[model samples]
Target: MEPRQTKLIIFTAKLIAFLCFAYLTLAFFPQYAHHLLLVIALALVVIGAGSLLKYKSQRNWIESEAKLLSSEEQEEEIAVSQYSKLKYYYPVIEYAYSANGISYTGHTLSHEKENLWVPEVNHWGDPTPATDRWWLWFEPGDHIPVYINPQDHSEAVLVKDMTKARRSHHLALLTGGILIGLIWLTLVVLNYTLPLR
Candidate 1:
């Protein structure tokens, strides 16, 4: 999987999660609280959109000027990611395997419903194994090995993890999550604090 695809998967998940959250709020909240929740949801949608626009503009500027920028500056970004120990990767390994004391045995598979990564060796459309392991499946191919940062095991991901526009995608999704959480909390607070109830 490429960075671009990983970002798409992550962003899609964020969008779906927010929509579900909104639906749940609308179904349960009273009129006043529902109003607040709706406003918050809209705000998140707008803010996330605005961020995309800004990112695209900057990307365009970079693309047009990328030729002029020093090669060092142009390539410095990925080399300076959150993980530094990933100096070398063993691309020969396949099959997503995790040795979190229990040695999770599973292949990386996409969760169509959740739109995110799952540790289950099973494909989507199944339940009871709603458990989470650490491997992120990218593309369709069993046991695709991915290099991990030994320092922080949680930061490990398969080759498909970098998705195109990684920074922008992560920023937008994180903002969306924060916004949804804020909206959810606000609705709960208003529901309990307001005297109208």
Candidate 2:
């Protein structure tokens, strides 16, 4: 599926989940809302923490000197329907670097674009590999900064600024988790003190 389609599906699913939870708490199971909310809040907090920790681990890879060996634009076609087709564009890049006297070849730019998708549309508002935004970043035989694992030289990433977006995403998750937890706690307190009975 296209990236936009996948994002839409995920957003729709989250909205539906929130609506169902709200209905249950407000109308059908008011007495159990506190407990349910607590569970949901805890789940979000745990997921957020896990994401933050994973991002931190990735951030530990030290910067290294690497040179782009080759860069190629690749395309794949997907049949959206009998009458329409979608074309996705991506850059295939190979780079070489040395760490600890061992030379390593890496093809990974970043995990963010591993599954990036671009639909065949004239006006795409979202970030898509089809645009020059990504291709313009690097060229064949260009020297690029890379991050490599000190212990394992073979593991490396070619995209230097990829961590900025990743950090923001994890920070958002942590913030969302804290907000949800606080909201749930407030609801629990109000349930006990307001004397709705």
Candidate 3:
């Protein structure tokens, strides 16, 4: 499948999961709304903290022009318990960049953990041609954007869509946190307005 299609499917799945979670929490657990809201708010805050840490880590990485030295697809077998083996493809990339007249090599792509694996089989357990792997966006000799550590010039990474993803993650966490806060407030209002048993 194309990258756009895969992204759409992932987004749809996440939306469905969030909706189901919200529905289940609000429907059968109305009596525990306050506790649930508190838990959700804490979870969102933790996620936001994680994003903030990532952002801070990369904040000092200086952007520079780099040349793609090589790109290769390597396969690895992971044991999912003892009965099943999952094959995953990793795109190995090597790039070279120069900073302050010092030449350095790097292999990291980004800080975000990207889901680059696609099941080789369809939902029915039949073989499929789709091998979900990182599509190499830069070819050998291609000039691409790279982020290098100013302190350690050798440490570098190819610039993926990190900034955009970080922003979205932060926004999602903020929105979820605010929603939970409102839910808690509503519960409090109702508790005070309703007569005590």
Candidate 4:
């Protein structure tokens, strides 16, 4: 599939997250809770991640300059680094990555559109500027927060968890709405439809 399709899918998923969180948050803490807190929080989280990505990029640039001057290192050409560190800021660290059993894998930001090639972040040392087919193996970097289980680090994933915590919240909300409908049905049955006499 085209990369853009994946992006739209991810984005649509986020909107779902926002809507689910908003509806559930209100159902749980209602009245002013949804409009006041939940909606606002979701906006901040989504917006904050964008801002954080830019901020982190700038910060990295500044750090790079400082390092270039203050420290002496071997010659290695630097390329544009992909993805933002905002994931670390959010609650993603709680989930464990399944692929490598990592809570978080070093995100490799894709610059395919910009005609740039970046390698995965090298854990043993710094990453290589070298690029090839190995570069396109993983999905593009997600500025969205990612969560992974700690037990198995490889099981990490981009935000939008289908975990129990997220699911239970939805099911609990549905029960209340469903119960009212069930009660209405019972009353109608006794009133005329069933004619229990």
Instruction: State the TM-score for model 4.
Output: 0.25
Q: Compare the candidates by TM-score and give the number of the best one.
A: 2
Which parts of model 2 have CA positions greater than 4 angstroms off? Answer: 1-36, 46-60, 73-90, 114-134, 137-141, 160-169, 189-197
Candidate 2: residue 195 lDDT (0-100):
29
TM-score order, best first, reads: 2, 3, 4, 1
TM-score of each predicted structure versus truth: 0.25, 0.51, 0.46, 0.25
Per-residue lDDT of candidate 3, residues 39-149 (tens digit): 678778787767667657877788899988998876657676789887656577888889999888887876543423444565577775643343445479988889887
Clashing pairs in 1: 1-160, 3-162, 3-163, 3-164, 4-163, 4-164, 94-143, 95-143, 95-144, 96-143
The residue-by-residue lDDT of candidate 2 on 1-197, one tens digit each, is 97647987998998799878878786876666556656666767786677666445667889978888888776767777899777767677899999888888998876555234344454454544435446546776788889987667788876534344555666677777788778777866676542234
lDDT of 4 at 44: 46
Off by over 4 Å in 4: 31-42, 45-56, 59-197
Which pairs in model 2 have colliding backbones?
Answer: none
lDDT of 4 by residue, 37-74 (tens): 33444444454354334333332221100001111111
lDDT of 3 at 104: 83
**RMSD of candidate 4 to the true fold?**
18.9
Worst lDDT window (10 residues) for model 1? 64-73
Candidate 1 structure quality by residue, lDDT tens digits, 32-143: 4445444665666666565555334332221100011110100111233566311211111123334444233222222111223332233342432423322222233433
